[model samples]
Target chain A: MDLALLARLNEERAARRAAVLVTDLQSNTQRLVLEKDIMADPLSALLSDALRMGKSGVVESDGHKVFLTVQAPVLRIIAIGAVHISQALVPMAKQLGHDVIIVDPREAFASPERFPDVPVHAEWPDVALPRLGADRYTAYLLLTHDPKIDDPALHFALKSDAFYIGALGSRKTHGKRVERLQTIGFDEHAIKRIHAPIGLNIGAISPAEIALSILGEITAKLRLKPDGTKIGN
Target chain B: MLATDDDLLRQAEEWRREGRGVALATVVETWGSAPRPVGSHLVIDAEGTFMGSVSGGCVEGAVVTEALDVIESGAPKLLEFGVADETAWQVGLSCGGRISVYVEKVT
Candidate 1:
């Protein structure tokens, strides 16, 4: 690979942009294809497929073999509360290779000492989220259970392309939350995207168990198709 | 913190920018129950120093040795290892898997 190409690949990744490094196995030649430029390339079909599946593999392009090294943006977990669940979530999420950021307006809850090793923003979601900028790869965890904090974050997450938006609450609490969102102009279809009563149907009582269930659900959302079938199976 | 493949690539670039001879080995293909997935990387410098793994440490020694050759020759080589190989007892995967690694010099 060319040094310039390697540098560009790293640059694209740092900027959280999806890209693919295409290498011709026979000629030893390579090219870096940014996500935006894939459609214009000759190997657009193969490149798009590989990018969609978020996997790298060798594909047959016009009878010759080419290896596609797909570099998807790193997945991020933006927890809206620095509560115990979020504290438990930090290490587990990191182990699953997801970058985690904790946000809570409560200074005591958002202290770095409580959530050591992860970024803890002691500011409201509205103030911190914009600076953080949630993208398609971000998973929003509305664990505050405080509508004042979680509602604003939900507004931003609903408007964005965040893949997962889970809010911590009971069925009764979610009913009230849904009513508030409706009055605030969110339609039923949009409101349905928020995974209230968040996490899988596991009998979780402790914060750590709840965190595991939430991560499990997030993993399912990430690796499974909408119909619950595995992606690229 | 676990060093991701992204970190490995960034470290490889940094090593190359420092005027060191660098070779990158990627698991381009895997068969059976491979230890590491395809696209996994093991970056080897000319001094036989490496930072990542293409086979979960099963065949990294052989890969680093081949990567050193690629660094010196500036030619990419595709290497395969499996239980079927004659060197299986030495450097093959213990999981009874086969993997094809593509080793190339980073110029």
Candidate 2:
């Protein structure tokens, strides 16, 4: 590996951009293909599949073997409320290698004492989310259950390329929420993206169990194929 | 502290920039329930100091030993380890898996 190439790879990671490091095992030569340039590459099909699956492996390219080191952006969890479930979620999400960020306008809930060693924003979603730069790799958790905060956050999340957007609410609550979203100009297709009554059907009762279920659903979204089958299973 | 792949790659660059001879070992191939997936990285310096794992601590020792030679010579080496191979029997993957590692020096 060249020092310059390693530096460039790290640079892409810091910027949250996706890149694939292609290494020809026979020649020991290497080249990097950025996500934007994958379609132009000769091995575009293989490269795109690798990027979509976020896996790195060896592939046969024209009778020679080349290793594809897929460097996708690290996944992030932007929990919209600094509440009980969020407290439980912070450490669990971190253990799963997803960076967790908390945002709440209430200074009481969003404090260092409650969430230590985590980045907690004591500002409304409108003020905090833009700075967070939520992208396709982000999973938005609207746990506050407060429309004042979650609704504004949804506007930003729906507009962005965030992969998983889950809101904590009951079916009745979600019905009203959908009506509100419709009034705000979000169509049926866009509004359908939110996973209402969030998390898997784990029959969670306590805060910790709910947190676990939410993470379970997030993991499914991250790992499952488009047809609802597990990837690499 | 769990070190992610991002951290491992960044540390490799840091070690190389500090004038230390560094070699990177990556799991390019895996078979039969390999603990670490492909693209996992293990970085070793000249002093045998290494971080990260390619096979859940089952083969780091062997990979680091091979990496030292890779650091000495600029040439890269492809090492395959499994329970069946004679050379890999000493550090065989207990999980009954096979992994091919690509070890190369950072220039």
Top DockQ: which candidate number? 2
TM-score of each: 0.94, 0.95
lDDT of 2: 0.92
Q: Give the CA lDDT, 0 to 100, for residue A3 in model 1.
A: 93
lDDT of 2 by residue, A96-179 (tens): 888889999999999989999689999999999999897789989999988989999999999989999999999999999999
Residue range B1-107, candidate 2, lDDT tens digits: 53788899999999999999999999999989899989999999999999998999988999999999999998999999988785644778889899999999999
Residue A71 in model 1: lDDT: 98
lDDT of 1 by residue, A87-192 (tens): 8989999889899999999998999899889898999999999999867889999999799999999999999889999999999999999999899899998998
- CA lDDT, candidate 1, residue A157: 92
Candidate 1 residue B85 C-alpha distance from true site, Å: 3.8
lDDT of each: 0.92, 0.92
Provide the lDDT at A36 for model 1: 94
Per-residue lDDT tens digits of candidate 1, residues B1-107?
22888899998999999999999999999999999999999999999989989987889999999999999999999899988884543578889999999999999
Candidate 2, position B107, lDDT: 96
TM-score of chain B of 2: 0.94
